[model samples]
Target: MPSLLAVCAVHALRPDSGSVGVTAIDKRPLDGEVRVGPLGVRADVQASRKHHGGPDKAVYAYAQQDAEYWERELGRELAPGWFGENLRVEGIDVNAARIGEVWRIGEKVLLEVTMPRTPCATFARWVGGAAARGWVKRFSEEGRLGAYLRVRRAGEVRAGDAVEIVSSPLDAPTVLEVYRS
Candidate 1:
């Protein structure tokens, strides 16, 4: 019953820090269907491939519920893709999603939950400067890190598409548990 609230991607950018970056972390909602390939959403780029973007971590999804919680805590409006998620979804417990879970988006694109997103220094830098360290600490302590997914079937995905869980392995750990460990 969960649905895709947004699909987002971003182009490369050069930060003021004089470093070459492709931190597509600042994504914006796409208006129409976007291709979902084995690498990830079409045109989405990762600044640091050493830590992100691979066959096992192609796509990232965040639950709207968790965003709402952060909005309240940060006392600021958190929009879709605010946390650099490729997919903003609703009506699903992303924190409870286990590894090996398969999600069929719309009628085509299929994705499998692979792991939880671990907070990184790049993320902290993207969020804030001096306070970034504390932000990462708080975020880790919250244990609400979103899920990373790998594409199982390539197809087009769009906002409002239904997300159906086709399978979830019983032996796998939930996203929160993975974050804690």
Candidate 2:
């Protein structure tokens, strides 16, 4: 069964985040349950409304498998939420999730896969150091960052929650298809 590994949200801001100036990309995993709404995890800050945060981009999720891949490539261990993902999951291919596919997280909160996260200059700067060099280009080529989701039903969420796929639309594009296009 697919499970939510962690629930991450902005704990602070980085001032020199390239184009964005300030960013909430450096999120930290939270303890206990958290309330989630149409806008996303309550109190999670999105520095740029134009680039992020809204009904469609309410929650961002990255698969632990993908993060592990990066861990090996970057030759470093990564903490939960390091990728700015509200939810880190395992046993599900988030990149292959189809657009409009709905998921029931835990006993509540129905969310729909909306799109894939687009890497920006802010993300590159947030990475910093040798990894930051051509980071965006390499990330784009990899194209398995994560998926953005819209809340279909507001509810509470926490780590260790079961993630159930409730619906998948054959007509819709997969998250990876949308990302690479």
Candidate 3:
């Protein structure tokens, strides 16, 4: 059984030079249950709505396994939400999750895997420095970019909740495949 390791949310902010401000992709774990609504996790903000946060991209979930891989590669420990994921999931192969796959969290919140998060300038800037390019290239090539999900049923969610796979459509491209392509 997969489990929710953490739930995170962040505030939107303006970048130093760019006309478009960046949502400081810094997400911190919530202490208790948080509401999941049609748009997304309540109070969560996405600076770039053209590329993120919509009915098809309401929530973002990253697998702990992928984070562990980055930790090994970067030679640093990464906590949940380090990659700006709304939910840090453990014991699940997020790369293999298919588009349209449905997952139930806790009792009522339901989410459907929709797509893979595309790397953006905001992400690069958030990472900062010369290492950003390398990180982007490697992440793109590796295809472990994590899955974007749409809210199927609005409810409360929190860490330690069980993640139940309600449906996984056949013939749908996996999240990793979508990322790689």
Best by TM-score: 2
Q: Candidate 1: misplaced stretches above 4 Å? A: 11-22, 129-133
Which candidate tops lDDT?
2
Scored by lDDT, model 1 comes in at: 0.87
lDDT of 3 by residue, 1-181 (tens): 8999999888445463444555747777887999999988887887778788999989999999999998897778888878889999999999899999999999999999999988766676666766577677778888879899999999999999999999999999999887777
Clash count (model 1, backbone only): 0
Over the stretch 59-108, how does candidate 2's per-residue lDDT look in tens digits? 99999999999999999988889998899999999999999999999998
Error of 1 at 50 (Å): 0.7
Clashing pairs in 1: none
Candidate 3, which segments miss by more than 4 Å at Cα?
11-19
lDDT of 1 by residue, 1-181 (tens): 8999999887344362414454557877888989999999998888778888999999999999999998898777888888889999999999899999999999999999999999876677777745565887888898778999999999999999999999999999998988787
Order of candidates by TM-score, top first? 2, 3, 1
How many steric overlaps are in each model, in order? 0, 0, 0
Global fold similarity of model 3 (TM-score):
0.93
What's the true lDDT of residue 100 in model 3? 96
Residue 131, model 1: lDDT of: 53
lDDT for each of the candidates? 0.87, 0.92, 0.86
- For model 2, the superposed segments whose C-alpha errors exceed 4 Å read none
TM-score of each: 0.93, 0.97, 0.93
